[model samples]
Target: MLLSIRPSLFAILLPLLLSRHLPTAASRPAPPSDTWRSSDRFMDAERGTHVAGLSDLKRYFSRFGYLPEPDPDANPTDAFDDRLETAVSLYQTRLGLRVTGKLDAATLAEITTPRCGVPDNATLAPSRAHSVGRFAFFPGEPRWARSGPIVLTYAVSPTATIHYLPRGTVEAVFDLAFARWAQAIPVQFTKTANYESADVKIGFYSGDHGDGEPFDGVLGVLAHAFSPESGRLHLDAAETWAVDFRRERSAVAVDLESVATHEIGHVLGLAHSAVKNSVMYPSLSPRTKKADLRADDVEGVQALYGSNPDFSFSSLIESDTTDSGSAAARRGGGVRSSCMGFLLVLVLVIVI
Candidate 1:
C-alpha cells in the first residue's frame, strides 16, 4: 500500500522513525602548532568560571561542552605552559586527563585528533540486497517498525572491537542512550553485553579505523556507528574521549554527548529526519543542546513501536509551520487539516 505522512509531526511521537544520519561539524584541516598558544580569555564568551584568570579556562571548556577533565598531555602548548598552574587546574576539573595540559595518551588523542563526530555508517546497498520480508508499522503509521533483532555469530569483520573508556562506563553511556531513545518511542527493549558472546560486544578504534571511513585529524571527524546489526558500533581512537566533556573544536561546534546520542539513534534502526526540530536531523543546529531530544526524535521512534491504545492530550506539541514548503507539497488538494499538536514553548528542542 502506498502511503505517506508528515514525518515532522510523527518525529514528535517516534523520534527515531525514519531518522537521518546527519553530517555535523565541518571537516577542518590540522591546526597550527600554536592552537594552544592563543587565548582571548573565554570570560567574555560565557560565564563558565568564577576565577578571573585560570578557573575561567575550565569554565570556558565547560561552556563549549568539553567534559571537565580530558586525557593528560605530554607536550603542553606554550600558551598553556605560560599559564601552567591555571591550565592544570582547569584540566583537572574537566577531563580526568593528566591535568598537565601537555598531550598525554587520552589528552593527546583529543588534541591531535577528534574525540567525537558523526559516523560514516555503511550504506544499505539497494541494487543487490536480500529483503527479510515485510514488517508493517501500526496502521496509519507507515514510517515506523520494530526490525526484529539479529545476533551476530561473530567475526562478521576480522578486525572489529568497541572503542573508548572502561567497559562499565561505556555500558552506562550506552544504557542511558537507549533510555533517551525509549523516551522518544516505546520499543521497550533490553540489552546485555557479552565480550565473550557473538551477540553484542563493546571497546576503541581509529580513523578509517575499522569501517571504510578514516579520521583526518583533530577536528576532521568524530566517530561512526552502524545500524543495530550484530550490535556493532565503531569509535575513532583519535578522539580524546573522557566521561568528562572536553572538545577539540575546529571550524564548527561538535559536542561529544550530542553526537553520541545521534549515533546511538542510528543503532536503534532510525534514519535521518528532515524536520529541523527533530534530533534526527543530520546537522545539529547551534540552537539545539547536547543533552535534550526533540519532539520529532521522540515521535519518529514511536512510529517504530506501537502506541498505547489509551492516549493523552499531553502527547501533542503543535508545529509552528504555516501553508509553506513541504507541508503544502504533501497536501495534494486544498483539503486543509490543521494538525492537532501542542504549541511548543519554553524549550530548547524544536518541534515541527
Candidate 2:
C-alpha cells in the first residue's frame, strides 16, 4: 500500500525519522571501563564478608588513590578485609559521604559514577587534609610559579582530535573554560598555535596513550589534567561529548564545556573538591552541565593565585543567577515548542 505524503508533512516526518535513527550515547553499549558498574553487586557489604568480585572494587579504590596498588605478582583476593573497609571509609570521607566503612548503596553509586582520572588523594601530606575545607590542592600545593602577571599559553593537539566536533568548536569551548578561571584569578590564559611549546597542552586520546594514566573508555573517566607546570589535559575520545544538550539528545552525552572547565581547574592545581557544586568536585553525571565556579572554587583558586582586581563574590552570584534564570526560560520554551510540533505532526499523520 502506497500512501502519498505532501511536501510539508514529508519535511516534518523526515526530521523525526532521521533523529530517531541517529546514533546516540544511549544506543551505544556500555564501555569496558565501566567495570566499576559491577560494584553494585557488593552493595551493603562490610568487613569480614567475602564477595566474588570484591577484588575489582579494590582496584576501583586503588585507582582513585583510596587504597595502595596491589602487587602485580600476587593474586588479588575477593575478601572484604580491614584494608578494604578503611579504603571505603577514606573514600566516603573524602567525598563528604557518610564514613560507614561499608559498601552502602550511596558508596556504590558514587563508585559507579563517571569521574576525573586524577587521584582524589595524590601524595597527601600531613599538613594538607581533606577535612580542612571543601577545596584542596596537590600534595606540594603546585601552582604556576611566576613572578609577574601569570600568563600561560594553551594549545589543542592537532593530531589527537575528535571527529565528531569541529576543531573550532573545541577550541572555543577551552577558550571560554580558561576565561572562567581568568575571571576569578589574576592568571591570564592565552590560546597558542604552538602545541609543543604551549604551557598547557590539551588533547583527546583513546586507551593507553602514554602519560601513565590511560583513558578508560566512555563514562569511566571523562578527562584528566596535570597540576601546575605539568601542562597536560586529556579527554577520553570514547565519551559522547556534547556541546549542546538540545541538539545532542543522548542519554549519556557529557557536556564538553563542563568537563573542560573542571579539568582546567586541575591544571590550575586544585584537586577534587568535596563541594558537589564546585567544578573541582570529582564526579559529574551524564546529561548534566555545571561550568560556573562556585564560592569554594573561587576561594581555592584565589588562594593559589590572588583574586582578579575586578572580581567579587557578589557580582559572580548575580551573574550566575541571571544565567540560570535565562537557561531555565529557554528550556521551558523549547519544551513548549517541541510539544506543539509533536501535536501538529500527529494531526498531519492522522489526516494523511
Candidate 3:
C-alpha cells in the first residue's frame, strides 16, 4: 500500500522529520586518521606505571597547560618524567579526582574527557578550597571600566560556518546567554547589525582562521573567548551544536547556550573558576546544557562590575545544576536519518 501525502503536507512535515531522525554521535562518520581520540591511549598510561615511547601524551597535556613540556635538551629516553607526575597530580586536584601523582584510571578518564577550548592555566586568581565563591579572575582583573551603567555592543559573524543550528537560533541562544549575565550586572549588551562596529564579536570557524588560536576539529576544544577589551568569542564550527535539548538531538551534542554563557564571561574579562559548578569552570562533557549562572560566577562578575541595583537574587536561580548538566550528556546513542527532505527545499529555493 502506498502512503500518499500532499506537497503542502510534505513541506510542513519535512523539518520535523529531519530533526527527529538527525545523525547521532555514533552514526556520524569516523574521524580521520590524524584526529586525536583521547580515550584510545589512557588504558596504557594508568597509575604509577612507567610506559616508554609516549612523548605524545606529554606533549598533548602540555599543549593544554596541563603539564609543562619537557626541556628541549632533556634526555629523550626518560618516560613519564617527574614534571608530568606533578602536573598530573595538579590536574587531578583541579578535576576533584584523587590526587594520584600518576595517571590512575580515574585521572585518565577525567583528563581524556572533552572540555572547553579555554586553557586550564588561563590567568585565574588563586582559589580557596571548598568556597562556592572561589571565582578566579584574569591577571590584573581586566574589566571594562565602569564609571556608570555600561552598554556593550556585540555582533555575530554572518559568515559563521555553523551548520548544526540555524544562524538565527545561534543568535537567539547567545542573546539569552548575554541576558543571563546582564541580569546580575550593571552592563547591558546590545546586538549590533555591523560586525566590525560591535565592541564584542562572536563567530564560529573550522580550522586556523588567522587569529593566532586555531580550532582543532570536534570534541577537543569546543570554544574560546578573549578576556575583556579584545571581545572575540569563537566556537568550533565542526561541533554538533545543539540549540534545544529535545529539538536537536545528538550523542555528542554541546549546548550552544552553555558555551555562549561561559565565553561571554571571558568577553566580560572573567577567568575560569575553581568551583566545578561555576559557569566559568573549564571543561564540559558532551550532550549537556549549563546556562545557569552560579553564585561563584555572580560574585566574580559583580566584584569586577558592581551588582545591578534592579537585579534581585532568588534561591530559585542560585541552585546549582552542574551534576544534572553532566548527567544529561552522553557520547553514544541511536541511528541517524538522511536529510533528503531538507535538500529538496534548498534546491527549490535555488531554482526560484
* Alpha carbon lDDT at 160, candidate 3: 71
Cα RMSDs, all models: 21.0, 14.2, 15.8
Model 2: per-residue Cα lDDT over 1-352, one tens digit each: 1213344555445343212112433463343352223443212211111112567677778888988888999767766689987998888888878778865545555665678999998345324433335788898888998878899999999988877788899999999999999999989899999999999999988767889998655466789999988999999877778888778665557889999999999999999877666788898767677888887788888888888999989965665446445444333111121234345455667777
Select the stronger candidate by lDDT from 1 and 3: 3
Best by TM-score: 2
Pairs with steric clashes in candidate 2: none
Residue by residue across 1-352, what tens digits does model 1's lDDT show?
A: 1012232433232222212122222332222232222233211112211222223333334323332333356322213334444544344333333555432233322222223333211121112122321111112332323356322332122234333344555555656665666554545535544355543343345434455545433333455555554355555443334444223222233444556677666555555443433455444322123444555555545445544344332543443233335333422222112111111211212422
Q: Tens digits of per-residue lDDT for model 3 on 16-37?
A: 2223223433543343333334
CA shift at 201, candidate 2, in angstroms?
0.5
Local distance difference test, each candidate: 0.38, 0.72, 0.66
Which candidate, 1 or 2, would have the higher TM-score against the true structure? 2
TM, every model: 0.40, 0.76, 0.73
lDDT order, best first, reads: 2, 3, 1
Which whole-number lDDT from 0 to 100 does residue 239 have in model 3?
68
> Is candidate 1 or 2 superior in lDDT?
2
Q: Best candidate, lDDT-wise?
A: 2
Which is superior by lDDT, 2 or 3? 2
**Residue 12 deviation, candidate 1, in Å?**
44
